[model samples]
Every structure is written in structure tokens, then in C-alpha cells.
Target: MSFEYYYITVVSLVIFIVALVIAIIMNSRYYKVIREYLVQARGAEAKGQAMSGEVEVLACPRCGYSTTIPFRVGDYVGKVVGETCPKDGERLVVVAIYSLRPTEYQGS
Candidate 1:
């Protein structure tokens, strides 16, 4: 082959190799970023689930006295018939625990 043809072929091959390497590098970086984002999303989802599974307490609205009553989402929370407020004579108000997902015992 002629010197000119050989030089052109070599240059073209080099260019093709460089382009392939750049493409692979870019793809690897993109995948890495995507994987990290997915991991963060999964972690956030787990945290949310754990928070939803937790039991919270309620308080007497009039007396501002807190109690460690069973908490459920969308449930009416109140004092029992014999229960009395430790802080005052005020009755307990029903307060539903808030959550993204509703709990099993979600009603009075």
C-alpha cells in the first residue's frame, strides 16, 4: 500500500479507538451515578417504612399532658373510662398518628 493510504488508515484506527474508550468511560460514569442514586432512594424508602412501623404517644389537649398510649394512623386516640389526666382533670383528645402508610389498627 502507498505511504499516504497507510498513514490515513492508521489515523482512522487511532481515532476510532479513542472514541470507543471515551464512550466506555462516559457510560461507566453514568452507571455509577445511577447506582448511587438508587442506593440512596432505597435507604430513604427503608427509613420511611421504619418510621411508619413505630408506635407514637398522644397527649391531653386541654392539660398538655402526654401519655404513652398505642398509636395508629387515622385512629381516634383517647383516655379509657377509668383513665385520668395526670396533669389536670381535662379529658384526653383523640389524635390520629400521621404517616404515609396507614397502620393496621387505624380506627377507634
Candidate 2:
């Protein structure tokens, strides 16, 4: 009957709204946890930890002018990406990689 169909539709609408509200609340809580974690990590960095950075050596094959760039994600030695050489305006190559480790602090 028409009345039975109308009742089911109303119940379904209410259930959908409830699910949407719960999902939004869960998403907000997840982001709040992530923000807290980042805050803690930044505090650790301020205490002189995580100061060293990775170094990259990129060289030009045409003119032999090498460049150093801080290594990041998706960058590695010997993988040629589209980067122009600053010295000779030629295609550059990643020649070497190194990690810049900070020296131990002396209790002076």
C-alpha cells in the first residue's frame, strides 16, 4: 500500500542522515589526532633532533657542472628527471647521494 511505502521511505531517510552525521564526526576526530601527532613531532624537532638532511649531487653531462640539491621523495641517484643544468643550460643527471649528519654536541 501507499502508506507502507511512505513509512519505509521516511525510515530510510532518517537512517541515512544518522550515518552521515556519524561519518563526519569520525572524520573530524581522525584529523584532530593527526594534528596532535604533528604538534608533538614539531616539538621534538625544536629540541635539536632531526636536523640533518639528505644531500643530492646532480651533474651536467655536457659541461660537467655539478649541482647539489636536498634529496626528497621520488629523488635518487642515477635517475634522470627533467632538470636543466644551470651552468650550461643542458640536461642534468643525478650523480651521487649523501646524508648530512650533524656532529655530536660537545658539552663545553
Error of 2 at 22 (Å): 64
| Model 1 Cα shift for residue 41 (angstroms) | 1.0
Candidate 1 wrong stretches, greater than 4 Å: 55-108
Residue 36, candidate 2: alpha-carbon lDDT: 93
Q: Which prediction has the highest lDDT against the true structure?
A: 2
Q: What is the lDDT of residue 96 in candidate 1?
A: 44
Error of 2 at 59 (Å): 0.3
* Model 1 lDDT tens row, 50-76: 565644455677767755433444555
Which structure among the candidates has the greatest TM-score? 1
**How many clashes does each candidate structure show, in the order listed?**
0, 0
lDDT of 1: 0.65
